[model samples]
Target: MAETATHSGTAVRVYDLHKSYREGAHALEVLHGVNLDIARGDLTLLMGPSGSGKTTLLTIMGLLMKPTSGRVELLGRDVTSLDESALPALRRRHVGFIFQNFNLLGALNAAENVEVVLGLQGVRGRAARKQAMALLDQVGLADRWSHLPDEMSGGEKQRVGVARALASQAELILADEPTGNLDSRTAAQVVDILRHLAHTENRAVLVVTHDLGLQEHADCVVRMRDGTIVEPHDGVAA
Candidate 1:
């Protein structure tokens, strides 16, 4: 596979993906020849019970883990065979991650937290601050920019996480149970922001969760079971 970026608008494509781990003398398979596409401008939900390999698939798609055997294309470039050193830069350039714990710096305020990500993208000093403020405003957290993580509510902190993710201008956003720490109402609000980012900003957002309330907001809901996709959603290849 070539590493050329084609104009396909696809954020990620995995073909015949598989993952396995050696436990004692037995090789335990965690993924079973999975095939999927997470397209740009879509909110895709990966849902299933515990130990279903959802996180395994997500880690591979996010370029955080290598599959046992598969082809992974990100932004139309074949990344499965890239060197480990090369993947960090590529993943940093294209992928933004949202964690369930909100992963904010306890010492930094909202704007500073977001600016930290901009710094990783080589935007620093005044420019990073300005961009961070703009992103906080976009996420409806402009007023909370000066508040520390402990001072903010769970929902507010998650919104800041979203802003930080956007600071990198990432084409693909991988969210792992983004709303797990919030109340129902707050969870819905966060999901709304994710969906809006996908539809309006044309970012491909893939969320791994068992939250049934999020189903209605997703463009496609993919269900996995025992390391394999059991039901593929309509309008999306899985």
Candidate 2:
């Protein structure tokens, strides 16, 4: 990976990225010198078949895993060299992660679920509550603020997850198979919200998914095959 700094408008950049795992005495390479840039104000899609290393790349960019070799810059900061202990704080400030499963607190309502994130960022008391409500409203869930995860539909729960992600004020949003569990119509609704976030809010959103339907809403589409990007980021917004 190059040691160059990430550009101002870029949210995440990876250069010459490589990752490998030790299988007994052999090193099995997963990512082969992958290079990509996720720009601000764009919803990017990372699509690939199983074992193509999409989740590996996403986890590394999200600062949850270390690259075996390469450079990772997040929001213009060179995070590749940061200490492991420091990554969580940096990720909390700059990255919001959404998983395939709705990782919500079943006991907490939609607003409280989002409020928990604000609280972690030190915005507590009435301020956290107010901001959480505003975020829920942004995801068109204001009326469902009091609903728990079980009380909501799959799409509604995902919206709460989206609102919770936004509560952190994260500049980069990384989602893994966000629509994997929803029906076609519900998936479209969720993707529309994500597209709106990237365009209107100017946040960089990267979704790792197999759903080609999302391509219509993506600002950039990256394809991976056999652990390397076979398709370039051809559709990125200028």
TM-score of 2: 0.93
Reference-based lDDT, residue 29, model 2: 98
Check candidate 2 and list the clashing pairs.
Answer: none
Whole-structure CA lDDT of model 1: 0.87
The lDDT per prediction is: 0.87, 0.86
Superposed model 1: Cα runs more than 4 Å off: 1-8, 233-238
Candidate RMSDs in Å, in order, are 5.0, 4.7
Cα displacement (Å) at residue 99, model 1: 0.4
Least accurate stretch of 10 residues (summed lDDT) in model 1? 1-10
TM-scores, each model vs. reference = 0.94, 0.93
